[model samples]
Target: MKQTVQLAGLSCQNCVKHTTAAFSKLEGVESVTIDLDQQLAQVTTDTAYQVQDYQEVLGPLPYKVESVL
Candidate 1:
């Protein structure tokens, strides 16, 4: 499955990579694409995961998940 999530506090392209890597480490996640310019993240995964899982993956970074669709 694929999910598009609204993101906040993504200030640079490097941040995109950081976020992508975090999500990529998850068991179910196959891929992660974060567009800093668009303030969005496209995540592809096969297993069910919760939003809190993402928050934990991101650590204490100043980011907010505005939505998931």
Candidate 2:
């Protein structure tokens, strides 16, 4: 499965790295690609996951999820 997550408070490569690391650790996530320009995270997963699930994963960060596209 694949998901594109729209996020807020992401403005640098460091943010991308952090987001990538976090998503990569998810049980079914296969990969994560973050586009800093658009503040979008493209995620590839092998198992079922929800938009809110992704949001919850990022809750502890200094960022917030705008929506999942």
Candidate 3:
């Protein structure tokens, strides 16, 4: 499964790094790509993974997830 999420309030690459680290810790996550200029992240994971599961990963961030697709 793949998920693309829009994020708000990420100001720099460090924010991207933080977000990537958080998602990478999830059990099934295979890859994470953050487009800091666009404030979006694309995550690729196993078939069993669900986007809802990532909510927990983003919960502590300064940015809020704007959408998931």
Candidate 4:
């Protein structure tokens, strides 16, 4: 499954690294690609994941999950 997650507060490469690390840790996630300029993440997973799940994963971070599509 593939999902595009719109994010907020991503200002640098460090934010991209952090976001990638966080999502990459999820059990079923295969890969995570972040576009720092667009503030988006394209995640490829082996299982279905909801927007809430993504939000929860990023809850403690400086970035916010604006939406999922």
Total backbone collisions for each predicted model? 0, 0, 0, 0
The TM-score obtained by model 1 is 0.85
Location of the lowest summed lDDT over 10 successive residues in candidate 4: 50-59
* Top candidate (lDDT): 4
Best by TM-score: 4
> lDDT (CA) for every model shown?
0.82, 0.82, 0.82, 0.88
Tens-digit lDDT track of model 3 for 1-69: 888887789999899899999889988789999999998889898744445666677777887777778
TM values, all candidates = 0.85, 0.85, 0.82, 0.90
| Model 2 clashes, total count | 0
Candidate 2 clashes between residue pairs 3 or more apart in a chain or in different chains:
none
Error of 3 at 26 (Å): 1.5
**Candidate 4 accuracy as lDDT:** 0.88
**Candidate 2 local lDDT, 1-69, one digit each (tens):** 788888889889998888888778789888899999998889998866666787677768887777776
lDDT of 4 at 44: 97
Give the alpha carbon lDDT tens digit for every residue of 1-69 in model 1.
998878889998778878888879888888888888899989999976667777788887778777777
Candidate 4 clashing pairs?
Answer: none
Error at 58, model 1, angstroms? 0.6
Error of 4 at 55 (Å): 1.7
Error of 1 at 11 (Å): 0.8
